[model samples]
Target: MIELNWEGVYPAVLTPFKENGDIDFEMFAKNTEAQIKAGVHGIIIAGSLGDAAVLEMDEKFELLTFTIKVVNGRVPVILNIAENTTKNAVNFAVKAKQLGADGLMLLPPMRYKADDREAVEYFKAVANATDLPILIYNNPVDYPVFVSLAMFEELQLCPTIKAVKESTRDLTNITRMKNRFRDRYKILAGVDTISLEALAVGADGWVFGLVDAFPKETVAMYNHVKNGEFAKALELYRWFMPLLELDIHPKLIQYIKLAATAEGISTPYLRAPRLPLVGEEAERINKVIADGIASRPKLD
Candidate 1:
């Protein structure tokens, strides 16, 4: 396995499913290939955007094994662990490492909202379980628990608890993390809408959903920003915002799948409880994707 470079665009890729509720490995390959070809640095599988909650543990490993083979060591493949218990999370983390995962994107405990101590301890347990580097999914806005800076202080003892997928949405937290931790944690912007802003304000990379749909444009914007081409990146970001906002919605899985379907890289099909979009919601989001695609800026 290669070293885990926690910087650059890592798509929290969706699990494309067939109508029969089985994994669509064909569509999955298409999307993952698109991302890597477009210059993304890493891939995160089975995230919230990947419909992680509904997936069986065996199903997730199936995705992981297939992704690792598809990726072919071209880039790091990080699996997301969202189990409801520490024991399960630890067990999954061990298996993920054994299965050739480059890293783990471990979320706080599911269902029950753990307090600071509990959350920190939970993270520590998983870190101790596997040698795989971890990216803590710190999305308090969506998840019930918030991994505060103080809690991170307690988590520092776990050397394997590496980068953070910063989804707090408060951009200042990026600065605070930098101030307190220095280079200890690589802060990747987890919110798609504010990704450019996060990068501008010192985020090391972006762990986003929209990249699954618009890989070229997403990678282009990241390059423009890193090259100090603010005018160019902002112009692209302004045009990309409407489609990007689709990642933050309650039905983000549905919305992103629709966007990817429009691009011909993914299907609109999803697992149970997450049906395809329809009616006005579908129409509105489709228009945003259509308009974005129609007006997409030329990338050199």
Candidate 2:
């Protein structure tokens, strides 16, 4: 089993697709390589950002296998499990480990908003099913299921559950988790808008979205904070705010893909139920990327 440090920048990457909706492996590799080259500490594949709900199991496994080869042990590749059933989630976890995944980013059971007991049981079942270290994706704002402090206390019984992605959109929870758990679970900031604050307040790491487009800038912000260069980090964060806000929207995949396109690292193609951005929305998002690029900071 790979040791996951559960710290530093980890991008939940976009799944590049052709206009015909086919997975574009070439573009996928380019973006993944860019993240690795930019010094991101880890990579997450097929999460909410990666269009996991739309991808078939075979495609996810193929992505997992291909990413492991492309990453070549340069950084850990963690797969996101968003299944709606404990059985399916456990099955995927076991297979992910078998396929060489270094860790997992597990969401609460999908579609059905499980209550506290149901959610804890779901998480425990997955944790017991495999030895892969799990990062609980606690995004109640989007996922509709909140993993409360009480719930986490029960989840502590599963030693394989190692971390929590704090996406409740409340920065105070970072303090709450630290005060309560005291390092039992590594806390990573999942919301881009408050990431710097989360880090300043002592989040172990950030699982970011815009890093898929602006890898260097994202990693630089993280390094700046870690090095105690608050002024420089805040400078970069202010510039990044517009693009970072894109990650919180319902069509974040489209917005981030457009940003990645401007950087020449990705194309703006997406599978349906999700279409390419058009008209006013497209023009506005394009300008945000353009302006950000025109004024991008010089980092060491």
lDDT winner:
2
Model 1 per-residue lDDT tens digits across residues 1-300: 768879899999989988898889999999999999999999999999998988999999999999999999999999999999999999999999899999999999999999888998899999999889999999999998888999888888899989999999999999999999999999999999999989988999999899999999999999999898999999999999999999988999999998999899988887767777778988898899899999998887
Clashes of each: 0, 0
Candidate 2, 94-147: lDDT as tens digits: 999999999999999999989999999999999999999999999989999999
lDDT per prediction?
0.93, 0.94
- Model 1 Cα shift for residue 135 (angstroms): 0.3
Residue 72, candidate 2: alpha-carbon lDDT: 93
Candidate 1 local Cα displacement, residue 254, angstroms = 0.6
Deviation (Å) of 199 in candidate 2: 0.5
Candidate 2 overall Cα lDDT vs. reference? 0.94
Model 1: CA > 4 A from native: none
Candidate 1 Cα lDDT to native: 0.93
Model 1 TM-score is 0.99
